[model samples]
Target: MDRKSLSLLILIVLLGLCIRLQNFGEIFDSRIYYYGYDPYYHMRLVEAIVLEGYRPSFDYYINYPYGLRIDWLPLFDYILAFPGLFLGFWASEIFAVVFPVIIGVLCIVLVYLISLEVLRNEKFALISAFIFSVCPVTVWKSLLGKADHHIWVVFLLLLSIWLVTKPGLLKLLSGIPMLLMALSWLGAPIYAALLAVSSLFQFNEKEVRIVGISNLIPVLSSIQNLFLGFSFLAIAVFLLVGSFVKRFERRFRYAIVYYLCICSVALLSAYLMPVGWLGFVKSGISYVLGTDIYLPTIREARSFQILGVISSAGYLFFVLAIPALFMLRNGFLKVFFVLSFLISILQLRFVEVLAFPVAILASYTICQILERVDYPVFRKEEEGESKRRGRKEKKKAVEIRKKDHATVIAFLLFLALPCFANSLAPVEMTMDWKEALNWMKENLEAQDYLKAYEKPDYAVLSWWDYGNWILYVAKKAVVCNNFQAGADDAAKFFTAQSEEEAMKIVEKRKVRYVVTVEELTVKPETNKTKFIPIMQIAGYSPEYMKNKEIIDFFNKTMLYKLHVENATNLTHFRLLKNFGTVKIFEVK
Candidate 1:
């Protein structure tokens, strides 16, 4: 790398890490990572695997007693295992801050290398990496202690794309990263599917082959028919072909060989492996299908404005990338970009995967703008210095070019300001609510809530939104978590007309505690309650979601008065503790 490029690369990575650490100033400062759904979910899992040695069976933490088995990918969690053991109970907090930032920082380097391979221009690649490094949502999602697996998924995707950009034998060995990518996240399948399909474009290539995946670790998971496992089995068949035919590359269908192999494995898996394989594929796709229209989700269900973390300028390039791919058609990266972009619009979480391509395309657009002004940074090597002298004869054009230099700089800053601005959003907002959870942990007795015969069991009845946090932070059983039925129950609990009705449901679930954020409460004078929109329930549907359903559930039921003075006599509930805006009420 050139001296300037290498220096800028290091600068971008350092800046990315610093921006992500913007929320954190010191280690063990008590507020290291965001304390929300995915973060807490992973934290609880890491704590279980490392500290408790809690191997989940039919009874898992997420869905609670009703038990919806969340398909948890263990790759990132395994990375935290050893360190978590040393930290003991504090494992999640420490690992949360460390892993994401480490992976995110590495992404800066990976993104730069991937861009360099595609663009073959260090200048453009540096800009691409800069855009990615500073992307507001990217920064927030990839921050230290955030503890989401999507970053690993993104890193694997970029590596796979980078492999696609490689020459010959390297590309053939891409199944290695592809295998890792598929095992890492839900979206990895999309990458595999796209890669397989892209190979169709070059089916006629004379030296194509679908080699077997080298399984370094056997007996990975219980489900032998896992999609990731299927990926390997597909590779095994590919390798077996090499023994029979000397070279599968000589065939016209060589490029599509991987596609056929994966398809065959998938079909075989569906018929013989188990119905879960088909169900898994269906469930994964159902998430992004806008038509599915589930009640609440983290991403697409909400309006596009929900993803305000990404600035309008950044989003403009994100839109530009569709055409950008079409412009650079007939490549593996283009296929992946086009597919990822298509899915991204359906969900905001999926947008992080687009950071590489979005940044790459944005960099190209910036370069194009600079090229128009004949800016030195973007200008191709000139044959003569007199070219500027000759061009100077056109005084008007020279003045226009000079005037545009400021425009280029302005535009660069304009595009960058939002990402940095977004990075500044209060990180405290994530874990601030954990105060309620902490209070419960210190107060609640030690035992599982379902075991009523042993001790008076306790369960926290809160909205499904904070269930993960309550369980993770307080080590208490939550009435509802990510499960849809649990969410429905919580919704009913809050909206019920009478305390007796709300308590009936709470008692049925053995919920000793009912938690509510002060923001969700109404102003006693106004008789109005605000909708604390459920974070994950933010859906991509265009169907107008009436906030009134939840807001009036508080107002119409007079539940808002619970936080106000002398609102109503405690018929069936008693105040336990109030942690700032977070309030806990005991079911009387």
Candidate 2:
């Protein structure tokens, strides 16, 4: 790379870092807390690896009375624990919080490299880097203290793409990132599927062989079921056979053969194992459509709305990204981009995955427009040195060039300002919940505290959203957690109208404490006494909250009594601490 290009890359990296870390103080203050529920669980796993030397096979802190198996991949936690190994637990926790910011910046650099390789233009590559730097969804997900595996998913996927673009054996090494990606997130299958399908269009045998082999590494190591293993194996076998087939002798192209092979395998599987095949297909469809029992209640699993994309990624980039896809020339990239866009539209959980593609496409469009501009005309000069020109002509030429430069700079900034501003969101858990959980940790006599995996004496009951926070922060067991393990009971416990009905669930789950937040009970801003999510999870109709009698009945339920009435009038519950917006109640 030339010095100027290198300097510009460095500047763009710095700008990306600045935008993501602008609220560093708020996120990593004297009392360090993570931004969301999942990060806390991730740090807890890191703590286990750092302190216990390994993650426990079974966790006693969540899904109380039955505990939960620790099935999450440990690679991401191991990466987080690397810093703690050298710096100690406290410093490592801080490092874990800051790790995503570093990865976020690395993603910006990877986008630049991939864009340059695909577009073969330095200017467009740099523009792509800048767009990704300020892309709001990417920035928000990778901000300080927002430590989650989703950012690593993006980074590893981009790194894998860049690696595959290299020549010779270097392309085979793409499997390393693919392997890491499989261990980093559960959605790695989406990427593997995209690559497998896109490779069919490649006329080069070497490209097909390398991508197929790279993908097989993940499947071999991570396979857990017979059906999924068989599915991937069939695809791999076809690719291996296609690698040796002579391109000229075939009546049909390899792409056609590959397509037919997949259809044939799918049909054969459906015929041979009707029940298992139907279940697999149904589950996949339900998850993407958000039509499943649990998924519809989770915020991130809901179907995407265009307004949400505009809100998170900005209207300007979203507008340009549509046409930008058509402008992208790389076949593999176009396939991956289109698939990601479609999946995101099906489920919002994949929305952040659009960051890299949207940024590159939007940048391509912007640069294309800029390249079409007509610069100021000047007299043709000699190649080496121009003859002495009149002072008047020289001054006029200089003025015109300056005006053109200013106009280009102004136009770029105008397009970037809104996106940069949109990327400035900072997320932090409520201080009230933090203090309450801390108080429970210090004052409550909940357990023996002998071991990390030791079961607590009792469990806390709350909506599933806060279960991870209660487990990690309060150092106690919970009836439900982010995994949706005990979601049904949690929903039943909170929505039960009579003390008798609520107590039955509490007894079944051995729950001694319940947590409530303002949004669960009453929030004036939305003009609802209870949030809709709890109702949804409880299987209540949407119209239930509308009727006056139904609303009155809700006012008498266990959740309402705990938060609105302070648990004072309830027979089996007593309010222990009330932090205005957040309240904790002790079950008798």
Candidate 3:
């Protein structure tokens, strides 16, 4: 609460802002350019909401002729859309680009507050905030132009945790953030599960009630259909009975019973309505655990290696974080850290959540080590004798302590340098891809492509990676996109053994254009090729690319003919544009 502490916290937040904004110039040429696949789709949705005043429940642009129901939580897109209500579309895009940075900076402040609560030391709290500010795991996802729900997920979850730690009225309102978290990300239920389990370590009635009630809102709202309605009513009755009749003498027993009851409701709902809440939760869990059949094809779903973790978290931070898990005094944080770390090892996307507790625990451990050191700067001056000592001696001690603080701060900054440096790079679509999509948009519009069902006359067929870009930038229909909806068909079309087989898929799906990236056809010198992943997703054996016969077969596929051979001699496909990184072909 002191001025110095407040000043330092402000400085730490500013530091995070600077790091997140480091590549802002590259992302903004004439206008804001988003950094990744999902952001583009979200921005597209935001524009829709801004102009239409509500998100269309079903979007015809994605998943081609079948279309796709918009299942994503509207809260994040709504947040971006609100700006457009006052400032129009372009301004909204600008706001969306910078929104993640604003959330990231706020998260830095929350980290400090939560750390202070758990550690009970302002010094350690400040260190934790500083650590999180530059932590690569968080910085990369929360950078400017990376306007995805992930940053909002981190912020709302952190806010919920910090709220739960408060006393009285503030504690009761904790459920609000948990509700917002649920609405922000489909993965929020898993976090609620973790929090419920953590309660067994340190049970708090208010915290449990807040989490339980907040979790129920999402489940209850999923009652539009008959089966879900019945399931919801049944779960509601069971919860009422349990609340009144289930009286346990022990707090631990109460915690266990409530947690199990919540699980039961989820299981029953999932059983009754496979297409509802449980399905979504299972999909999230499957994606995080890499249990989904197609998850390995997605880059963020890949398991993290030890070296990757170290690189993202920093070598020293990882080293301290592991021990700090045990050294941490707060039971909730201890359990949360272990759960997040274990899951993060399986899926890289979970690393951002893991960063929260890692910063706290690592900073806690650092403070412990520094405090235990024999150096005079860390040692408290003798109290009784200090009263008798001259003012000069006391002032000298203060000066030494100041120097000590500076030394430790310098050392902490040194530990954070690697993560800071790693967070500097920004990922965006190549200019070639951008120009190609722009050209596609202009040509499609010129051809009166939007006459039917408010959709383009034809769908573009591309790998799942470029689906969002094609959807958002080209403003066209797509066979497959970031949602992984039409990926199997895409894989089949691209890897089909013959142009005839590929044409069957294209004709079946009404795909008129095929987009190809060189990475899908050619291997990079230093890295593995996307062709292998495409092959894998299409059900090829792991070593298919290694076999000479299979490689020859792959060379004959529609993807190779289009991207590598320029569709030369191909009968039914015509090359439209070759933009080096991106290629477009029209099905004739």
Candidate 4:
């Protein structure tokens, strides 16, 4: 209700909006949004689901020879499909642009709530909220169409933390959101683990024993179903351990019972929900064990390093605010802050999650340090004067609080400078292929196929980046894309063979065109034999083989011809179309 708190809330909301709204058009209007192979696949599947009013069979995505069934998590695509059904595809694209911004703002508000409980200072809470709102990685992800699941994961994780720390009638309502969060992404279980741990520490002993007994009943009832039975047993163990640790007592037994009943109801409902629980269980286990996963490569390491440095700087600012942590004097807050900090550092991808906590701790530390400063007026006053000065001090404290509010605002703005810079220069926007995509749209027809020499998903010619655009704009099927984890056909296409062997593939697949860029052709000397140079682009050099016999063959052959003025670079050719950039001909 205070002026400062109201101002801070407005500031956090505005910061979230500004970061999320920037370049929203980039995602909403571009073919690139659809080009990413997974998004493309999801869009197609969602469209089918909407039209058919039924989930597609798993066989639809797993028709390759390998017989691998990829069970994709469906919550995000399903949510997207609903809007698409009402608004149609274009409006749905716009929805993707705005949805994450709304979620990001909610996340900011939740962070403030969590911080206020921990720091007990409105100013410190606002600082934490500001830090989260402007984090570059958070902002960047929120702007993209594909960011729905990631933002939901972060928001739900924070909401769960708030619920565990503050438990009330309202907090119990947090479970609805938690269920949605669990459905949102493969990473949901990690957040669940954190929540369960936090909740375990807060539970009492007698309540735990009752819950443990109740959980065991289900296990005993389903002992014949090994997996299901074991899962129930594990829940029972967790309940017992949690209850014992917190020393559960008779006074709180009813609360514990209510909590267990809610969980049991949730479990029963999950079994009957028709939400592909079995598929989720299988995929979730596979994800945890790191099977069939794609990891960041050396090129991706550069972006990670940038994100890491920015996050670490935010933590440093928080450490500088150490005095506030001590001044707040909340034992639970201290434990949560320390544990969250350690967990954030342990995982590189999670650095953004630490920003809010660090900022709050830092703000609290700063406020406490300011409060303890030795003013000359206090030191010089006599006993009577001290009493008079004490009254004056109360009035002065009000003024100082107002002035320090501005200082906190300024400090947050300083912390957000890095994020602002990053927002303007996203790693994806600066790549050369954005230009290549433009060129292809102008020159190529809907039916022309593109055979890329390099593996596109490697950031050089990332399959995810262009695959959907090719499908949407060019109406072409890519030889391969980033859906490599589950795209067995695409994976096979990449490993198949040289241009001579590719000729057979092209004929069999009825491929009409091949596209090669600088990055794809400039490989190591060892890979040269594996790839025959069909076209030379900006960054290539070809060695000439000269002999009277070879010269005679070149002159006599209809297959070989030069298409460009520059022999060393920028040549395009077709094997059959001798009029174009066709470098060689195959007698079809």
Candidate 5:
């Protein structure tokens, strides 16, 4: 790498480190807890593996009275857990900080490489790298020490594509990283699909044949695992399609034979890695179909900004550079650029990783345009009488071209203002539940059970948000939490609209304290909020009991007193009594 490239790389790495290291103590979501539902439950399995020498099994959580099962990809959490194995808890946390930073740096570097290939300009590539590195949405997930797998998935996707384009022994060696990435996150399959499709448009007959033959071993080896094998087959199909479309009829037969061999191996690998495939297809389908099983619109889609403008416009501007990629002589770069751009739009999480490669192609295109518009000194004729004069003119022209290029780049950067602005905001802001946890730990006796209005992961009185984390961090059983899959009937009762239905959970669970956020307490008198009113509204109904009613019942029916209160400058209320966001109340 040149000095400029080296400097840029170092600068990006430092920037990533700074962002990821800040506020490491905060839990962005309860999804980080081992016992939490969905993503966190899977993370705990990896933690168990590292801390207790336990291999994750479907039955890992079966022994618990709760019968919580540990299932999902173990790779991302394994990365987090590996550090814990060697460095202990503090070191593990540090590893989480460093892991995302390294991924972010790699993302920048990949963008640079891809940009250099397409734009053929180092300056543009550098700019692209800087923008991607500092992007807010990208930085937010990477910095938070949690079960989020998007960053690692994007990094591997970039590495895989880079390997395909560069093509070397080292490039071939990139499969290991790709496999590791697949293990780390479910998004690997999506990326692999995009790469395979793009590869068809990019590679030539000879290159396709070579890649087809080269990938056979890995494909065969992974056949027992259908998903892994499919990735290989997908790549082969892309190559075959690319070659056939290029009128390389002679190579078509060979490609077909190679493809069949890959398919056979993929079949075998499917059997071996059966569990790894769970929820992959279902989740992907649900997401695309907009179903309850997948990330709902509210969760996956970003809300309108303060000005009521959607943030997608910034993404649209970045996408305009795709057609510019075709200006490059290489068909491969054009296809790759289009693929990366399209994949990015498919999911918001893919934006950062996708941006890097897209930027690289954009930079290269800009460089090519500069080269065509103005002749360089080296291109001037030296044998003619006017050669010296022409050279001087060419030099001046080159200087002008460089200045113009810089101005154009500045405009592009300005257009990227939204991306820069988004990066400035904190990604993973959350309420500090440490005080509440500490209060519960210090005061509550071992035998005493705290009832939470919402399922807390730990033993403290449960608020809806803290349920999963509480369970994981406190190492104590919880009544009800966010795990809809595991909670079954109990979850239904907690979320029910009827007060009698909700009371059934409270009475049956022997919940001593009802914890809820202040904002969630009000009962709606309109049709909009027909859902269960956790707290009564003053003007709604005579039968609608407010916070005071719950408190009165707790005081009269049992020996009850407020044991903790957590107030903050923020809007959320944290009251230990049944009247507010309760932490704990003693039943005397």
Candidate 6:
């Protein structure tokens, strides 16, 4: 990379860093735990993995007496080992908030490199890098305390694509990133699908064979286990195969046949395993298409509607991107991006993966237009034509501030203004959530309240959305959580017609305490609410809850206590403690 490009990269990354800091005010508050609820779930797991040496499948919190095995990939928590071990809890907290942002900034580099390699134009690469740096959703998810596995997912994906595009020995490194993706996220299979499709045209028999063998490693292990062992083996497989691809290709048809045979065998083994790999496949379908009743209510599961404003996060990007997809000459990128864009249409969260290609598309087209408009950055009169050619030949620095510099500055302001306005406010943590959680942590019985002879435990009954946070902060078991397990019954319990109906669920689950939040509630007098989106998540209709016949029934349940005084006894529930907006009740 030339010095001019390097300088632009640094400046763009700095801009990304600044954009992510838009919500800095919300994260530092002592009263708030984390910006989002899901982060707490991951953070709690990291805490167990770090301080207690706890491993997956040994968790006793979320699922209560049955014990819980988190479905999350383990590498992310393991990645937290560094800051957690050395700097202590505070330092680990800092890492959770900062690490994703740093990764996010560096992603601009890979996107630029990929655009540069594929388009063969530095202008296109630089513009795409700049666009990526300021993307709203990317910035939103990369902020402090928003530490989900997503940023890592994006980086590993982009890195894999970058490696695949590299010439010679560097191309062998592609599998390493793909392996890392398998270690980190459930979406790793997208790589395999893309390659299979891409290879239809650019079919390198030896490369396909290497990938085929690498896939075999997963088949040998038990299904449902992270493919860590196989991931390591894949690196060596790719290295060896890359060295021999040309040599093995003399009988090209035979080599293709062999590769296909290996892939078929590996796939058959994966399906025949005792544990089902098919469940993951089914779950993906259920999640994206909402074929199962569970997914339609999930905000992330919804499609990105072009006119939905916030859901689309600026349609102009897509308008530019769609055109760029057709304009791209790279066979692999074109097919992969089309697949990614289609997936994003099925579920909006896939935007994380789609951003890389879309940015390249949008930026490349804009850069090409600027180039054609006589907006050259290095003027011959200023830099000397001989020096410019010499710099290009040596791959050295060239003056880039002559003409298009003004256009670059103006274009940046245009993109920045909309991104700034559309940026999501930092998830503000409220005092109510903090207060209730703190109270429970201090007050929950250390000795098992139930003497059931088994692992004596207690479970909190709350809405599923808050249950994960309850488990994380209160350090107590909960009947349901964000994972959507048993959510229908949670909704049923809250919206039950009578106390007897509700107590049946509470008794069945061994629930000792009940918690409620007032954040989404309407004024208490009417017991009516406009905030029913979450209620919809649990498979209950807003009208069903708010019907005139059931308005009294809804008020009696008191799912959210808007004020401390609002936590009062009604039927079987006895008021235990009140933390203003968050209140606790005991089943009597």
In model 4, what is the error at residue 551, expressed in angstroms? 29
Evaluation by lDDT, superior candidate among 2 and 4: 2
- Candidate 1, residue 581: the lDDT equals 76
TM-score of each: 0.78, 0.87, 0.85, 0.64, 0.67, 0.79
Candidate 2 local lDDT, 1-588, one digit each (tens): 799789989989998898877777666554777876799888888888887788776887788888889767778888888888877888778887888999999999999998887766776788789878887888888988877898898888888778777777777777678777767665566666656655555436777787667667666544644334444454566666656553532665454556547665874566456595466444444555677777767766767665666656545776787787687666666666677777777777777767777777887777767655643211233211344532333333333466775786677667778878777764446778878888888877766432556777788888888887887878788899998988889888878878899999999999888889877764433555445666777788756455555566567777788888888888899998888788988888
Question: Which 10 consecutive residues of model 5 have the lowest summed lDDT?
Answer: 530-539
Give candidate 3 misplaced runs (Cα > 4 Å): 204-288, 304-307, 374-403, 445-453, 524-527, 543-553
Cα lDDT over the full model 2: 0.74
- lDDT of all the models against the reference? 0.59, 0.74, 0.74, 0.48, 0.48, 0.64
Off by over 4 Å in 5: 16-43, 58-66, 144-147, 168-171, 210-290, 301-347, 361-397, 400-416, 425-432, 441-465, 478-491, 505-514, 518-588
Question: What's the true lDDT of residue 102 in model 1?
Answer: 84
Clashes of each: 12, 0, 0, 20, 31, 0
Give the lDDT of residue 303 in candidate 5.
24
The all-Cα superposition gives candidate 2 an RMSD in Å to the true structure of: 5.2
TM for candidate 4 is: 0.64
**Candidate 5 Cα RMSD after full superposition onto the native fold (Å):** 9.2
Residue pairs clashing, model 3: none
Alpha carbon lDDT at 301, candidate 6: 68
Judged by TM-score, which candidate is best?
2
For model 4, residues 1-588, the per-residue Cα lDDT tens digits are 598578769977886787676665555444535212345555555655555554443421222112223345567777777777776765555565566678878888988888777645565577667776776656654664544466667777677667645634444444445555545544544445444444543444553355444445434323323443455455657666667545433556455445655665765565546676455445434443334424222122122354464444353465564565566555444545555555444444455455555556666665554445531122332335767756444334323455555665575577566657765534343234444455444654433222111112211111233444444343344433444432222222222333344344444434444433232222233343211222111112234533333333332211222212112221222332222321212222
RMSD of each: 6.4, 5.2, 4.9, 10.9, 9.2, 6.3
* Ordering by TM-score: 2, 3, 6, 1, 5, 4
